[model samples]
Target: MSEPQHDVDPVRLGAYFALIEVSGLLRHAIEQQLQADGDLTFVRFQILRRLQLSPAGSRRMTDLADAIVFSRSGLTYQAGLLEKAGLVVRNRTPDDERGVTIAITDAGRALVDAVLPGHEAVVERLLFDRLSQDDARTLTDLLTPVRDHMRAAPPRSATPRRTRP
Candidate 1:
């Protein structure tokens, strides 16, 4: 039996590979900076950063998982680690006992503040410095729709999980 072929032109194929390569390289650099400056993994930094940016410095676990495109189980584990480090606190929502909200601590905010300068510098050096103003605008324009389209699918937290028999 032979595998079926789908049509993908060379230009699109090259663009896809280039995007993936660039994304991987950027993530590696960011991860190193996060680890060095804040003793954080990329996902943990993302979670902390998101909570830090929220007006109330907190967010529901499911919402956080969906926003960061992380699995709920993985986010829960990371949250537990953050909780242990005194960087964040988890509390059950008053309105919904089943729902948990994760809030950044003062320590968490301080850590984010400490790490941000290096993180910004690394991002500036690796990405922004390489792109012209117009190129940056165009890149954002091109990618925004793709991001929105992908996000239109149900978030992972909202998807039903399978049960074992």
Candidate 2:
């Protein structure tokens, strides 16, 4: 329960402080708004939004998981909840019987359609409206590298080594 001790390095500390504050505030605002108006968890909202806009209104489970950044079971579980809520349906794909597909239900589409504008407004107020056009472009340029970095699979947690004779 000890506090994390740090040898202060101004450059690193400044970077860490800025990152934590910005990211924490952004996520807090997003989660609060999503809970208030979306009637769905962040992950469910993502899945439903994707399926609602997807061609043929469906996508393979693996692809959906990838796009939504959830583990396979994590996505599947959330999809199950949506199905129980009549928001999405799971069916076996004819092309790949082994793979499942998810499609948004009409009600799901309606739900997202109703919520999307509010979501957009929240996003605009939190981010876009605060920036000028030129600043937005510059922000996009600065963010692209960070986006690319996230797309790469992160390294797995390290395992401890045992000494050998």
Candidate 3:
């Protein structure tokens, strides 16, 4: 038997899936280039960039996790790998011995600075070059609401509410 055809929801059939598919493709492309430069992955790049922007090129471990939007454990693991690579170091807070800060080493900044031009080229080649100025502006406007709502989403442990009868 042949499959039946039905109306396609344009947003679902076209937009949403296309966005995710492009994201996967972009991730693969960038990761491939990054791996060639070294073993650095995109996630590690993000972490290093965040630290690069901070005081003395460092931030509290908790703050780094939040800034990178990675779970604490995930951030810790990534930091550990970067640490082993001598790209970062975990230091006990001088003021509060109980706390730790993640510092981007000189090598980390150097690596990111070196690789950024290549990464920027990939992004430009993949998406930006294909977009006209007007289209890029429109895309940014369309994404703002989704970005805000996601930023405001309830935490994972929130309780579900009951519907009224």
> Could you say which candidate leads in lDDT?
1
lDDT of 3 by residue, 27-145 (tens): 99999878777568988998888888876798887666665566777778888999999999998978776667999999999999888888888989998999999999999999989
lDDT of every model, 2 decimals: 0.92, 0.80, 0.82
Off by over 4 Å in 1: 1-6, 158-165
Pitting candidate 2 against candidate 3, the one with the higher lDDT is 3
Q: After superposition, how far is residue 155 of candidate 1 from its true place, in Å?
A: 5.3
> For candidate 2, lDDT tens digit of each residue in 1-165?
999997889997998798689778776776677788866777788898899889899998878877766777788889999999999999997976578999999999998887788778877887888889999999889878987786765322111123346
By lDDT, the better pick of 1 and 3 is: 1
RMSD of each: 4.0, 7.1, 6.5
The better-scoring model by TM-score among 2 and 3 is 3
In model 2, the Cα lDDT at residue 35 comes to 80
How many Å off is the CA of 151 in candidate 1? 0.5
Over 30-121, each residue of candidate 1 has an lDDT whose tens digit, in order, gives 99999998899999999999999999999999889888888899999999999999999999989877889999999999999999999999
- After superposing candidate 2 on the true structure, give the runs of residues whose Cα lies further than 4 Å from its correct spot: 1-16, 154-165
> Which is better, 1 or 3, measured by TM-score?
1
State the displacement of the C-alpha of residue 157, model 2, in Å, after optimal TM-score superposition: 14
Steric overlap count per candidate: 0, 0, 0
